[model samples]
Target: MKNFRMRVWWFLCVLPLLSACGGTEVTLGEDEDVAGMKGVVERIPAPYGAGCGIEIPVEASYLPDPGVCGNGICEDGEDMYSCMDCAVCGDGCCAGGERSWNCALDCGSVCGDHFCNGGETAATCRADCAPKLGSVLLQRVRSCRNRFPLPCNSTQTRSEFHWWDDFNVAQDKQKRTYLAQPFNPGRDGVRHLVFIIAGQQDGDMASGLTGQRDGFKDAFRDNDGSMWVGVDGQSLAYRLMAEVYRSPDDTFMGLAFDARFNYGFTPSNKQEIENAYYEWLKEKFYASNLRSIYLAGHSRGGCLAARLGRRFKQDFPQVPLILHIFDGVCHVNDHEFGTNGSGYLNPLMNMNGDWRAYSTNVGAQFPTTQNLAVYNMLSGDQVLGDFADYFVSVHAFSHASPSAVTPSFTEGDWYRQEWFTWTHNGMAHNTVSDALWHYQLSCNRFGC
Candidate 1:
């Protein structure tokens, strides 16, 4: 990354007239001929038969005029000037003599447009050079993938959609800020967030929130600094229905149907989502200014957050994604919870239990892992549990009389309350926007 130093000098040619006094004609000197050269030298021709010094070769691109040189002699078809006696005129080539100059309308022959000097050649210089600008040609190439229109990489599926250029939010939105408000817009240390929505929609879900446009737009308006992406896990599964059976609505509870299908969401899908997410994430936020990312979610959403954290250090291996889980679960354990505080959630495992019972039962599967935070509020308490487990934090609150009061509610409880109660059956769970608000509040309150 060494910078080049440049200094261009223009020299005017001069010729002396010979008089009846019979003074000796002078030849050009190397010192006078070479106006702006570095690292070499030669002798010059003097009057009264003095030998002219060695001449230096100049670039032909800036050729001097042949009209009047300092040699003081008009020989052949050329005009000349005195080289030995005239100190006022530089000693360059005289008429009919060998000479050189570094001047040209096109220097492409000598050096390419963006030559070592860093300036464009005449033929390439434009009023604005932003488009032609390229990053410091990275030494290594990075891999990227896309997540939507499921059967993502299946050989059986043939998709008509073709999206290239490697999805990069940061690079594409150059100078443009995203997710602006709650988090100050244009802040360099912004983190990236990816949301993987998992659920079987028997109701009007996709219509209520256009997963791609409205969700992303609202997320951006709320906190436009971080990069955001969403993946429809159910859609992906439905697309791969040949591998698994689609559950019948009449066979299970609303939450049970989701848990039965999405709870078992495979690691393969998780890997694919993370792969595509960061491939584009890094390209967009690779600047030195980028901050660490925060992975988060709700029910199925929270599970995705955990899966990403667990394999992040393996799949993307190099990227550092901060793990944040909100009311999420991983897998079902048979450690009798009420029997020994392990599989106590077995009571609510009924396919026909209330939605709350299903949520609590699901929480058991999502125990606090070393890399993930399983945040959950106790059945009826307003205070969250051991959610502050270094990396994981949880909050519990009851919908009963006093606990439902906002004043008696904890901030974490307020989060879930506001989120689950946002729209239809908590279908409008905008983790990106929620995370942004929490991040802004946290930064403001604790200087995080």
Candidate 2:
């Protein structure tokens, strides 16, 4: 499919006090702007009759767009929903200034009240999503169906809930690094929590095509063709779920954690990281009124996701959960933050399974149960030849006995390993589109 992108540029608007400048001719360029915008030359009015470049806030990324759709193109539109494409809703893109908060059908769910959804009442954003209130006597009762009550299990309960956002992750980040986030928390409600973990990064390495964000938050994202890729790949899983799963009967939410939080980096740090995460995990039922969960992570995060999945599955045998390992690597970190925890990382980057069943080692130690599952996605990049010296080396899982990594459930273990051409980060940074959807379909049908 053609990767349709929307190009947004900071246009020079005529300022009120800048009438002293003359017009300057500039060339036009586009990453994915529609036709008729590629090679045009526009004259800009400058302040003081020279050249002035001052940027100002247009929209807060929330308020309604001023342009009317179906008439013409909206100014510097982001996607199909933002009313930039002028294309009507339901066409699969969120262009035309239509947002998930406004048009759930086209843009899907909004999360964290930012750009997407993650387990909150739709009515919180707009009236369309407002739960219908049925008049019962003098009071009105909200009529919502699948509100999963809390009390996750014996060890996990509602009273244990802590506002996830309040937990600052500064201890895990680099000394001066301020922009990278520790995690993005989802809302509290009866919904599915798609918890995502991002890949690893260090200062010694050069950024990839996806890691170009000012902060390391970029993820080679194919943002419904709105924002450029590598903009925010950390939250791709939840974003992809919105694109594929359109069941009005189901409500979904998501949370994304930075893999660099030193989870599983060392015995002590591993325990510390998991201690905090474990609390958050046990509180999912209380925090988001979670119904089910989908766990996905890349590189070191993948291994951690597996670890989390194992624990969650053991505790709640009746709860549904799925784990996706994107080239998982298991390593022990002993070095200081920002320095190379090189040894454990190098040997473990070759994500070989340590789990042995009858002396047969599988890809990941995680085994599937009646309700739980683990899936692995590997990059086919040759380790020594391709990414040997790259800062974030090839952490994609490769093995001689690929068939042993099957999910043992109904009808027998039928999953076969298939290698992909994406890079280590690409697995997490891609469009977060149909490929994952197809995988979910197969898993639902054939048990991971």
Candidate 3:
């Protein structure tokens, strides 16, 4: 009875303490008859019960929630504990490690991607590569123009021939134009005329005359005696005539038309351009008193010079006609030369005349006949390989079929070939003018 009373008292005392810590720990009977029974047991919270103030039951080894990833949405197959599991590859937006070459379908061919994929050329995407042939030609043209300005302003005598004051332009109904400039005009009837025809879309008469003036000045500087002829005390004797055509647009068609028709001679007339050249020539000089005539041209202009030279020889057989061709394009059809094996043979080369041809050996690819004296100028820069292939060809001489008749077989058979250390197209074209001036100076000094 005494022990039972003591146990009741202790149970009442412990019951209050056990009720106070209900969710934390539970105490069973001190000595229970049940198997595997303990004195005290930890109270595990219910499966969906609140433990640390939240409803979600967590294990001791549970990692913290990583939240959302990439665009803030917990995607399927993503690790609930990791945000990096949602990463995707080859996204077109260049996101998620997509590259232009590797994943071009998504990245589009953007520049600076370190890959020269798609239509990104060296000119368009220069950061990754070198310039292409087109870019090289463009740069060469710009550099040439910059190096040689329009007018020959380098010398005092050449500067006097201003475009507005000294030059006269004549335009026909077909819009074909030509310019005439008298270099040393005087009352004396004796005159030596020089006709300069520039390449397609090059420039107007001013540009041609400027090229001529610079060429003459360079020749005179080299050899003064033969170049300067005195018709009388009043005049230096040589005048310039240039056929100016329309400027080309910024498109390929414009370039083609300008090269084919604008600078080319008419198939029907053959004596002049489609429009004003013949009429303008007649109005400028009296044919009876003219001493001699020199015809010079560049590219397509060389074709025109050849055609006109043939006609001039037919018309004025007694007067001497000298032809100077500068990097002349050969085929009658401008486009056909690039396609066919016709080479650079032009009707001009076929014409029987005293000829002086100039070309840049850097780009000359065609085989030229040994009909005339050829000056092949080499360039240090070889970037214009395509240009050289298309324009400048390997010059081969053929003595079997001479284009022009010689006074003496020994003298005429001589190959007058010179190589200049120059590369630019402008420099190559301008070299003819320089040669002419030298020839004139030599003639004047030695009495030609």
Best by TM-score: 2
- Rank order by TM-score, top first? 2, 3, 1
Per-residue accuracy of model 1 over 306-350 as CA lDDT, tens digit each: 544544434443333434333343333211111112211111223
Query: Could you tell me the lDDT of residue 203 within candidate 1?
Result: 24
Comparing 1 and 2 on lDDT, the stronger one: 2
Report residue 370 deviation for candidate 2 (angstroms). 1.2
lDDT of 3 by residue, 54-118 (tens): 34334312211222233345476443222222323332232222335544554456677667776
TM-score of each: 0.29, 0.44, 0.34
* Model 2: how far residue 74 lies from native, Å: 25
Instruction: Decide which is better by TM-score, 1 or 2.
Output: 2
- Tell me the spans in candidate 3 whose CA falls farther than 4 Å from its real position: 1-190, 202-209, 212-275, 332-421, 428-434, 441-448
Q: Whole-model lDDT, candidate 3?
A: 0.33
lDDT digits (tens) for residues 1-448 of candidate 2: 1222212222222111112222344455474233445654544232110111233223212211323322355455433323333445555544333445555565566544343343454435432333221211110011112223632121111222222213433322322111121122433443555556655555322222112244432321211111122333323432343333422234333233333454234455554555556555565455335456667766666666767776676666556676666655554233221112221111222543221111112323334465654555555333323344344333344333434244211222322333454655565665244336544664475432
Task: Give me the displacement of residue 246 in model 1, in angstroms.
Answer: 39
What RMSD does model 3 have? 30.5
The alpha-carbon lDDT assigned to residue 434 of candidate 3 equals 55
